[model samples]
Target: AAMDIRTLTDDLSVTGQITQDQLAQIAAQGFRAIICNRPDGEEPGQPSFAQIEEAARAAGIAARYLPVTGADLTDDKAAAFAGLLNTLPGPVLAYCRSGMRSATLSSLAQANQDHPAA
Candidate 1:
């Protein structure tokens, strides 16, 4: 499948689900890290986070798993996503089932970062 990666910021991009085989291509794209937002077993034939993490490790790319369904995107989850974005080497690529969840999380993270509550 085409990567279909969409850049959300200089440091971050979002994409639909990816397979382990795609790690090399992702690394070649200059991304230093990956975040998997899709949960394991969400769909049949989907690669588990463990599988992706291992592949990423071999490819010399950092990996993080912050799985969430659309309804599970609470403020705390967004905060956690922000933490990952801040600490993970960039540019980072975050992916979920169709990319929408990842994009939504990225936007929430940015908004919270820009306007922290007093």
Candidate 2:
């Protein structure tokens, strides 16, 4: 499936399936990084991890895949996502099936970053 980049916040963009060509286009459009929120092997027809990573590398954009399941939104995941957000240059694009998990993870990461004591 083709990806649709939606701005969730100032620094975050979430999307559904992002193809290698789409990643390249996004890089051309000045996106700095990408995060994959869907778990590897979750769906049969999804793009492989290596394909996305190779595309990001070719496009000179940073990429990270932190697979998340529906019931696996742990604090560790949120913290890890926050860490990635902090490290990415800017305008990070996160993706998953239907983009729901991606958006949820990004939002939770931002919330966690905002509330240090939480």
Q: Which candidate wins on TM-score?
A: 1
TM-score of each: 0.98, 0.91
Give lDDT tens digits, candidate 2, residues 6-115. 99887888888887788778898778999998877777877887899998999999999898988998778988998898898888888887788888887787777778
For candidate 2, what is the TM-score?
0.91
Stretches of candidate 1 exceeding 4 Å from the true structure: none
Clashing pairs in 2: none
Candidate 1's displacement at residue 28, Å, is 0.4
Score each candidate by Cα lDDT.
0.95, 0.84
Residue 41 displacement in candidate 1 (angstroms): 0.4
Give the distance in Å from residue 67's predicted Cα in candidate 2 to where it truly belongs.
Answer: 0.7
Residue 17 lDDT, candidate 2, scale 0-100: 81
Going through the candidates in the order shown, the clash numbers are: 0, 0
Instruction: Output the lDDT of residue 8, model 1.
Output: 90
